[model samples]
Target chain A: MRVLLVEDEVRLADNLAAALRDGPGFAVDCAADGLSGDNLAGNRCYDLIILDLMLPRLDGLSLLRRLRARGDSTPVLILTAKEGKQAIIQLLNSGADDYLAKPFDLGELIARSKALIRRGKGQSHPVLSALGLEVNTLEQTVRRNGVLVDLSPTEYRILEYLIHHPRRVFSKRDLLEHLYDYNWEHHSNVIEAHVSNLRKKLDAAVPGAEPVIETLRGRGYRMAVGPEHTIEPG
Target chain B: MNQVKRSRSIAFHLIAAVLAVELLSSLLVGILSYGYERHIHFHAFDSILHGRVDSVIGAVQDAGDVDDNVMLDTADLHVPKDDIYEVFNSRGELLGRSPNWTGTSAPPAIPPHRHATFSEIKVNGREYRLLTQQGSRIVDPGDPGGGKLRHVTVIYGAPTERLWRAIHAAVQFYAAGSILLLAVTGPLIAWLLHRGLAPLRQLATLASRVSADSWHFSPPASARTTPELAPLTTAMENVLQRLERSFTQQRTFVSDAAHELKTAVAVVKSSLQLLGLRPRTQAEYQAGLERTLADTQRLEELVAKMLTLARVEDTGAAPGLPATVDLVQSMQQAAAELETVAKLHKIKVTMESPADEPVMVALTQEDCSLLLSNLLLNALQHSPPESTVELRTALQKERNTAEFSVRDHGEGIDPADLPRVFDRFYRSDPSRTRSTGGAGLGLAICKAVAERAGGSIALASQPGQGTTVTVQLPLTPNPDAASQLA
Candidate 1:
């Protein structure tokens, strides 16, 4: 999953971006001011955006309003230092998906970021499933037939994106956009290599298990769906 | 504990003064009317007495016997039953007397040359107004030209008890009229005064309702237009507005301080949390620790600056700090302390003054040093490399003030930011990082120190030219120096 962070404090922004990347293995993009944040949000596609209320050039509320005005439905998680019930109500009413006050726990922030991304993709549970395969989004791990499977961070991110949109055919470019931020270089062959590794690991976890991923000719990939796939409670 | 005396109500005082004047005037009118009435009644009584005496003399007639003497005609005489009279011929012998006369005191003897005399005499223990007169009557007027002329003296007296009663009745009438007038008008005056003073009462009620939490002051329209209450109403409105402004400023300051402190703490906390996120090599760990240490130091600097601002504001309220420090010496010490910072920035800091005399101002040494250091540091931060920051001092003899100014040749402030530069925690550029810009409390502290010492401070800036801050403090008079000069 890819996410965007808009914050003004240099150290706080750096720390939050690092935590999101390391904990959940999600690609994170950061904007230091409201104008640039607005500019990036308008031009990019992301599953979630973490915004700070106090910023230079344009305030957080104006940027949020502008984002919503343009009908961009990306889930926004607000970070604010202002203390008051009225301010919180105003933020939520202005299309903020969730809010966290300043000096928040790094662990909690990462957890919430992952949850927003999952919900943004219309998945209710923390763990996404397909035909005997289970991907735990919170821990960034995979299992097939209740057997743990080891995978690289890139391979896991590709598998995570495909499982979130089950049965939808995604081209190589779509997968690349969803799995990486602006900081990463995108090459169509890179997506092929990661997906190939991810498929081998899932099939190897249980020798007799059916394949959990399918490739359509000329259309990149989709999660394998069958009567055996059932979502588990988080 | 001392008890405060409750002030008297204005309405009560006004009513009392009006009633007093009414009662005094009533008494004066009563006394003057009584005297006038008595004088008129007495004059009418005297005229009636004189007429009665003339009637008595007319009753004297000639005696029908030889020797030509006049005799009193008892049958033809007419007078009041309470009156007494006597008649006599020129021989001084009594001819006749009234039937009511038991004259224990003889009428005063009248001189023959006098025509009449009137006196108040007591006869038989009763007061009388008596008139004695000499007159002539014609006896036998049928004779040739006229009958023989016979001169006679008559004395008549009337009891004055009824006259005294009439005069007493007149005086009583005047006193009753005055008392009645006072009774009818006393309450009327009181009610009129109360109606006239309604605006004042309304003004008091409105003023009494004002408090710090609520600053609403809308005086009654009548009060505003009334000549007596207009100035008072205006003064009260002005005072309330001033108090509200001061309270709002205090609230804003507290909220801003809280915001700055919270942001600083968040920075340090996030830095530490980021360092502990993953296991790393020893070298990486060492670098992370050093970065976190730097974040903590910035937080510490913010907290210290906040405390300094609070201390300066607190002491500013209490007066009478000893003005023992020499301005020149304090400036030198401040400049010396900041020399290393200037050297690092590659900026020149220089001091200039017209004279080398010691300029003593009303401030303590610690406050003087703090003020100068804050100003100098601000100048050094904004000054460009190889530029000069000038510190100029002078004694303004005519104004009895010691003046100093700090001028920096750097990028000056925007006109919009100049007005709020002395406000606590106000930064002209919101994007300036904490490392490049101090916590924005330096100028605010300098202003507080300057005002606390009975001094004034002002700032002037142009966008491209430069910025200059001037401060003036009252100079402490030196008696020994003055004597030496003399």
Candidate 2:
């Protein structure tokens, strides 16, 4: 995947490029400031574009706006030194895919980047195929044996995040970052509430396999894959 | 420019000038009186000498002289006037003396030209003037020893005491008149000048009372009673009216700014409520709702900070709230509240050992908390996760200042950017994105709170090396001093 990086600070930009180069199947190009970043974004097609909000020429918000206005559907991830929540929300409202604050963990940054690409590719929708279980992204519908299942939006998001990373365990915080779109004040109960809802909806759709979405006790949730999945009573 | 307001009135100056003229004229009158009295004494002595000499020339036939010697009774030759006369034949000899001339100094010889000569001589511890004349008079103009007879020189001596006595009386009378003149005219001259200056005085009182809050400098209709003060009054009224307009303009600006901010805050709050009212799908909420909440929060913080800035700007707190507070205890309490946040970020905040005795400071409690909270919170917020933030307080004996400092080992600020950190809403990193949650008003408020407490706040930093923020306050008063304590 080819990614475009927009940052005003040369050193930080260079560092991010070096980090992104290590990501699997990724090629990264950098724009030193907002003007060139806007110009390049206007004319180019890419898998993903990384943006910095405090840019020298044109700010990230306006650039994001112009990109969206031109009907470009490329995923844009905002990276900024400012940690104020207001600015983050502004960027997200203007159509940024995801955001990472400065001095963030490199592993988290990479995970977020991959997640954004997966979302752009529509790969995050859960495709529960066995035992008549099915999840649809376009219609946002879940059905087992042609019967639709009702789930809240938060529950659907949790189910989708698990199904996307099949067999990989997710902590509550990871689910928060992946399921919800921006950083939020963390409350562990929010994950529990959504997880409970997702379990009820999935159980109503396909009654036998309770192990499909299993909680790893102190760890978190994971999507059971292959043949080892089994029904476990709550 | 307000000289009329500061100086004494023109009336007072005019009165002082007039009194000076009267005093000078009176002094001249006293000196001239003495000169006239001295002239009277000299003329009286000259006539007495001529009368005595004529009597002697007329009595020459009664002497029946035979050998150039005439014998005659000289008692009848004396003149009755209060003058002393002596006869000499071209020689320095005294032939006759008056009763009052017993101890008087004789006169010098007369000049040969029949003219009297006046001389000043001291007699009986006082000064006197003497006159002498020489004439071969034809006895009494009626008879004579012919036209030219034996020439007899006469010297007249007179006491200057009587002359001084008359001069002294005149000086006394003149001095008395001068005193009366100054006493009666001083206040009268002052009153006349004051009457002329009354219009200006009214103008001054009117102008002095004009202020920014009220510019009602309506000079009385009668203020132009004197034409001299009319132009001045008009000029002052013009200036005052202009100032009144400018002040009204400033007040309007402040009120408008306050109203706009209030409206913005209300709109943001309503918008947030609207976004939260509906049950949102996760994607829908993430797409828009969160951003709205963040913006609302930013608006709220901005409004609150602006209000605080306005409050701190408007009123000087009367120093009535002074109370002894233990700064160490205050910092410890504030640090306790911040500890939970600190632990989440893995940062350890610890208070350094305070002085041997509690560092008691005199300040309002609210101001103290505000001052310390801003410094400590800023340090924790700016530092890297897991970094240690230290709070220290000490009293400098010589400087009489109690100091509190917070040090953070984070990504330090650049030197050029440190000074601007205290300006309201001025963020060095302009984005003010969600992660920091700062409106950049914290430090500015801290500075105001510290100053209101009669203290000061300053920042010291080296880029990449940490930053230290310090506050200094005056120590509490000595409780042992009763006067100071009261």
* Model 2 C-alpha lDDT per residue in residues B1-486, reported as the tens digit of each score: 699658975666677778888888878876776566556754665565456556654433323344233233466565555555555543444444555556335436555664766667665565655656664533233445443244555555555677677768877987898899899998888777777767766887888888886788888777765577778778888888788787885565454344334433433443443344346678865755565566567667767776876666454556554566777877987798788888888899978845556676775556577678778888887788878999998878698888999999977787778877776544566333223556557888888777766788899987777899999988877523322332
Measured with C-alpha atoms, the lDDT of residue B484 in candidate 1 is 29
User: Which run of 10 residues does model 2 chain B get worst, by summed lDDT?
Assistant: B62-71
For residues A131-206, could you state the per-residue lDDT of candidate 2 as single tens digits?
A: 3456564355667667788987667656655654466788887766444322246688989988877777777775
DockQ of each: 0.44, 0.01
- Tell me, by DockQ, which candidate is best: 1
Candidate 1: chain B TM-score against the reference chain B: 0.86
Fnat of candidates, each listed: 0.45, 0.00
Docking class of 2: incorrect
For model 1 chain B, give the 10-residue run with minimal summed lDDT.
Answer: B477-486
Report clash pairs, candidate 2: A83-B433, A83-B434, A83-B435, A83-B436, A84-B433, A84-B434, A84-B435, A84-B436, A85-B433, A85-B434
The DockQ score of candidate 1 comes to: 0.44
lDDT of each: 0.82, 0.66
